[model samples]
Target chain A: MDFLGDYTLRIVALGAGTLGIVAGALGAFAVLRRQSLLGDAISHAALPGVVLAFVLTGTKAPLGLLLGAAFAGWAATLAVMAIARMSRIKYDAALGIVLSVFFGIGLLLLTDVQKQPDATQAGLDRFLFGQAAGLLRSDVITMMALGLPVLVALALLWKEFKLLAFDPGFGASLGLPMRALDVVLTGLLVVAIVVGLQTVGVVLMSAMVVAPAAAARQWTDRLGTMVVLSAGFGALAGVVGAVISSRVERMPAGPTIVLCVTVLVLVSLFLAPRRGLLWARVRARRARARLRVQAVLEALLDLDARHGDGHAHSEAVLEVAGAGRGGAGRTLAELERRGWAERRGDDAWLLTPAGRAEAEERYGGRR
Target chain B: MTGVQLEIQAIAAVTAAACALPGAFLVLRRLSLLSDAIGHSILLGIVLAFLVVQELTSPFLVVGAALVGLLTVVAVELVRGTGLVREDAAIGLVFPALFSLGVVLVARYTDSVHLDTDAVLLGELAFTPFDRLVAGGWDLGPRALWVMSVILAVNLVALLLFYKELKLTTFDPALALALGLAPGLVHYGLMTLVSVTAVGAFTAVGAILVVALMIVPPATAYLLTDRLGVLLGASVGIGVASAIGGYWLAHALDASIAGSMAATAGALFALAFLFAPGRGLVAAARRRARQRWEFPQTMLAIHLLNHEGLPEAAVENRIDHLDAHLGWEPAFAREVVERAQRRGLVRSDGAALELTDRGRAGARSSLARTA
Candidate 1:
């Protein structure tokens, strides 16, 4: 409670939560565009930019680092595009190469900085994996200032982004400036990644951008609903991770936030009602049950067709279908409830006209 | 040369050789990013091995990392089967969770362990050579070299033995399955090899550079050629060249050796992207320009012939008419006129144009093909 009462913790938590919301909203498009890995790439590529900015401005100001990171991130995106378009290398391969190379250069620069004997280098190192506990009020304000316009732009261009995502060819035919829209979207993603870097770091920032959106996707297919839900999930994960990190000792808030987002992703993977693994299993079970009932009805119809009076022996029919006696009996009760079958005394059951028609239609009338 | 420098160079050579083999297959399968996932997720294996053996430098690390890498593949496949997420997203989801778990374990057990995150990410290539494989104090700084050599040999043997099978499965899994080949088994086998190669290389080059080595070399090779055999050969060549070139560059610049190596590989990929024949940017532009010029020339010729009365049998003189319609210089007009004459499209004694039997047939066929 005392840790939570600290001003630094409160400020950092608020900033992380707000950044998480923006990241989650922007990440919906990133994931949909299959550019989730771009977040990882761009965040890493920003390292060189940060180092260069430090060298250029002779200060470790957040704004300077942000500009440098944004430039490098966009440069990485351009390199990826060039590799993909001009060469046989696929987008993933291009992304991997660019990310490693840029980050490697950044590391070389960091080592150079380390040799300089300056205490300010400590703050720059914090940007590597982020230290949320060190964030100031001005940082939080800056995050909101940048995040608000991004959210507004996304709102105004929601229809265009949706159309471009669903079908770029159609959008182009409709005179939508798809190229410009793509640039705007990529710019938004780069900004989100750069801002979130203060809280999530370069290595784990991608998880913040991808995990919440991926989790939210499991619960909904609608784009607007997904974006909103993902934003909510991201905010919750951010607040929970911040609180937990504050309560605990020696746990970095960035990885903690990523861990929380990851937990939500796992939960959604297994437990979402509409499209999760558990739901899929339940749906499969229901389908199998329906198939069994249809199979029984089909067997009964087969027996009726073979007999002149349209009647069949129930026990013999059940023996041939290989369903358990209890299952057959349960299915018989269900069919009767649905007005699909009728009891003939205690030894036999017969299909009603509707049952016979449905059975014939389903099984090709052979039975 | 200093002993350390020589040893590091030798290890880099071995690592580059090891990554090149399975990397060729990964690129072909479009699973290049899986190498990145495997590279990151192998930390789990290393941690698990340390937990079991309580030692950082044990053979069990390789086995454990291999197991975890294979597990990453299986988990990704499981997620993909759900149809809820696409293949890329499934991969993006599963590996990060595994990697994050590994990071958390490291952070939680930092005091009890000597594993540094910096070492994990960047690798200690300089120190690898000092950890020698000496039996009875014989001073052998070649354990990594031997390990990589054996792995590379096994990989090559497996690829040679199953070349046809791998090709069939990679190009068309359905046909391979129908022909009674088990694609799943091949997939798992390839993944295991990738894991082994990744682990072997990680010791020498570190995770990030290993990832760069695995993807960039093969991707550059893909740009240069389309044949699988040539692609494999070119990838290995590129890997070796980058390893050597980057080692020297690092020495010259006094930079992080592994970082320089990865940057070199990236530079090679960029070079190939811009300059490789057929698919290169300059070549494509040239082809487009040539096509543009030839298309209009062909259109002008067709229009000239059509203007001479749809020219089934014969055509009248039309030089002045062509010049008026096409707006060509006399030299350009003469070139077109001479080309048509060479093709037997006209018989002009400085006066009239006529269609020969072959020319008439060619004109009709060309028009039909165009239509």
Candidate 2:
């Protein structure tokens, strides 16, 4: 109720929501291409572009800054590719080189800007970690204008992108222009990152790009579903993180938004119905229990075949049916608890008639 | 340079060299970007350590920060073990979350007054000369110099002591493990040193420069040489040079010293990328050009040999018909003929071309190699 009534909450929500949708949709491709860290590289590389734009234009207009950032981000990607292709240096190392160097240049320009006796550099630091409370309607409008095209492009080339992300070799076989598609996709990623930088900042913008997509992936296998779900999760994190940070004292919106998406990712990892850690653990436990029960029952049947049902079987002898000593011991104890087998002496078990029938029914064909 | 300027340069140089040492291994391992992760996450480590010790200059802070840095690596590894997400995604997921937590901690508790966030992100190397380390009232120069010197010593000592193990593990971890080198221990040990170096340098260079210093120089050196020993030496040399060069650039522009240092490192890497004699872009292009000329000549020689004294030779050997016969552009066919003629690999008579004995021999050798 409080969030609904608040005007700042609404603005933060709209701005962060737009950012989330754009970032989440683009991030799916990045994550799929194993370029998940590209977001981090591009965002860091953008700092120089932002600073250069300010110095070149003599103004900190978002449009000029965004253009500069896009250029720098694109150059960084190209540099990374060039370094990887031209030398033995791997892509990851190239990424590091580009990220740090570009950021370093940016820092130099930024500090130089601070040396001048001016007020323009006042909010420049906000680009590092972002200050969502400062977002104006114009910034939000600019984000929508930029974000809409990215989404439109993504829609226009959905099949090509899917093919490129999943199987570029096959896409090439299909006579698809993969290189052009790659450039266009990376271009979209650059745009998404630039738009979000003002709100989430450079340091935390990568999380907006990666976390939502990562979370969405855990929930589905279909690319289309993953994209839609990622966009939804991103929007949800955006609105929730923005609203909470706006209400809380000393809570920065950028980090808060990142943390909110992280929470979603963790929840999906551990608690989602079928793919979750909890479910996997439960399934594994059930499988183990089934195996142990089968082994004990089979061992009991072996004893019946040799010396009749009442004959006690040694723990070591029963282990031949399957599993370790501790496992067989536990299986025997479990059988007795279920009234499937009766303990005859120390370290021994005898199968009940009912247990013999059950084992026969389940593992009869296997033997 | 002035005395203060010299001190600043010394600090920056030592810091870069220290980062470059462990960075070589990271680049080789293809985990160079992990240094960036460690660099940012270490801020959280520093802030948490500061909260506990309540002293900015406490040794416990370094230990706490180093431990937290190690924790970042371990956390990344743990997430990677899930097999659901990729290594880069895991790295992307872990560092930002940890870094954001650190940011939130700094923002909420300190109000950013006690610990200037700007200094942490873009370190004030120019101010390094002011933070003098005094022991018992005796001035010990700049604190950054002392701290970075200690880190450098640690890096050098560790590198010297574990040279063989590090080499084996880096080049072939499975072989190192077979020889009882404990590759896992070496990996964690190297990670610890990386974190220690990064944390120590954080005060002088900030997170961005520290990451740049760690990765860029090593990568540049990798482009120049293939020898491990030379890589190490060149990386350290490049790191120091970038530091000095960056300082001067900052002086000329009157900008952030740490930032200029990072830019210098990037510039040096770009230079190596384009100009390194053995593995540079230009050299590679030249090599490609040579292969292109030689390959077409070989194909022409082979074609001539295949159709020698045959009726098809009259039509196939002609320069105009070769384009359609071999699917080459007409200009390319003429260029190939001209090149082959210059090399004496082929004789162009009026309207026909024939491979010489030398051309046939060259074709045979090349074809043998391919086969």
Candidate 3:
């Protein structure tokens, strides 16, 4: 059976895709600003908000819970900023403090709510790890309603937010209210986190904010391109993970989606152009090879100036030309492969006309 | 209290102290989130070890977890060294992927392995007493208590032996490097202790509260003291206190012990953040309040001294026109005038205000400081 043919599968895939796009876009700013961990802190902090909203409102209406999650996450963000700024404690420590304490508070609340005799909170803990199959049509609707405004706001504040991410001090010096803009940007991040909490769950939602942006960063230097690419990667992972998990028996979509996105991050880290690890290794290897070829060519050219063209230089001369560091045989073979140098009588060598020309182009004028 | 209750508290307190010991250094080094990372990544080790050893309580699990914890640090450094990702993002990238893999493994083999999700995330601090360590036929109290005590003792010994080295390296790495002290060696050593401590505390504080215990108490202590010795001692004391307080909080509410403990630690940090002398929120705000008046008075004095004999002196000195001349509000000008008069910095000559000798000296000193 086709996976998208199923109603629940379609709903969850759509919901997760929407969440990915929203988180991926907003998360780019967080990643660029060096606050990738702030997303982690806020996602954990939103747990108590989710539980408290359920306890106080007696309704699991998405809006009320979302508002509660947003408020708590926003407050946690403020607390982390305050602690980092007011005290000697650094930002990581501050994030640690706020995140765990708030998460602890959330856990306590969750346990308390579950113990109630009349409580209908059986599905509440599911928000912790997220069961994407539990995502209803209404939940998908709520995600869209929330994500639309968030992406719109992101588009509207694109320039200011970009400045806030890259050079907030310069913006502040220009009287741009950098602090307020920071609050707004972080607030959007909190919203981004809360919306995804139902789909990805609170625990893994932090990865959603980081993996996409980090992967996208390896591909582009432009902020606009990075943001768009990040969103695209996130959505791709979400839809694919959702669809695949729907087919697999007993495989939870949330972790599966996280696994998918993580694969993307790993792929990007090793394979993306320019900044990719594989590319860096390849470029370094090529550069080293080019240098080796150039050195051997220049040595041949040096010999040409001394002994005239096409002279069969002994392997001993090649060793001297190689200097104390030897690899003359391999260099000669590579030269032969490139038709640049020819071996004479097993050990001696001669530079071809083209090889001499190439060497001259590289070293003759500079030498 | 019953022996069971006492043993549980002992495990909690000892675990807290053990975490706080290396935790203070982590907080000082700005690697507090590494605790969070280490705590989660160690789960992978524990899970893999469990799969092989077929026992969750095996010491091999601790060894495996510690190795994974170290691997996490190595992995983070590798990613960050690439210059493709920032340090925090590197952290954010590495831990969850490890944790997600662990979750996947646990979920995949749930039939054969009873890796309780709640027990993994929240721990079973309350059940620590039930898991008694037995030697030959002798019951030697709770296993967690024994694990934490040995780890705590190891942490204390390590701290005492290397206190100076740790202090110098943490406070001034460049100076330490120039003096031939290997900061990198000290860093890995501290991280090893953190990883081992995290594994020991994993059962009592759970994984997340391991981070809370390691960070909150030390951060709270940092607010109260700048001395390294005092910081270390206070961090331990605060951690133990939070453990006890949190144990009681969970007892009262019948909630998660580790979470309650973390909340208690946070509450203590909150108290210090709001009220710690010289550095608390209240103290800093009060200091700024005083500066508000102090700054304006110095500016007024400077303004008066600059114009005392100039053509504008009469207009600038006139009490009625002071607001217009200085761009101050009329009410504020009057208030400044009254305050200056009361302090004997100025005197009224008809409608014009004159700066006295003390005011002139104050203005001159202010000018000297600025120059």
Chain B TM-score of predicted candidate 3 relative to the true chain B: 0.88
| Poorest stretch of ten by lDDT in candidate 3 chain A | A318-327
Cα error, candidate 1, residue B129 (Å): 1.2
Cα deviation of B255 in candidate 2 (Å)? 1.1
Q: Lowest summed-lDDT stretch of 10 residues in model 1 chain A?
A: A318-327
- How close to the true structure is residue B3 of candidate 1, measured as C-alpha lDDT? 77
Q: Rate residue B369 of model 1 by lDDT.
A: 95
lDDT measured at residue B60 in model 3 versus the true structure, 0 to 100: 99
Which residue pairs come into collision in candidate 3? Answer: none
User: Which candidate model has the greater DockQ, 2 or 3?
Assistant: 2
Q: What docking class should model 1 receive?
A: medium
Best by DockQ: 2
- Compute each candidate's TM-score over C-alphas: 0.88, 0.91, 0.91
List, residue by residue over A121-232, the lDDT tens digit for candidate 3.
7567767877788888988888888888999999999988888988888888888998899898888899998999998787789999999999999999999999999999
Tens digit of per-residue lDDT, candidate 1, span A1-367: 5755777777977988997899999989988988878888898889889888888888877877788888999998888887777666778787878888888778767766666766357767766868788887877887787788888999999999998788989999999899999999898888888888877777778887888999999999899999999989888988888988888877768878888988998899899987889988899989988877877887787777778497746755675666434468888888889998888888578889998887888885552
What docking grade does candidate 3 earn? medium
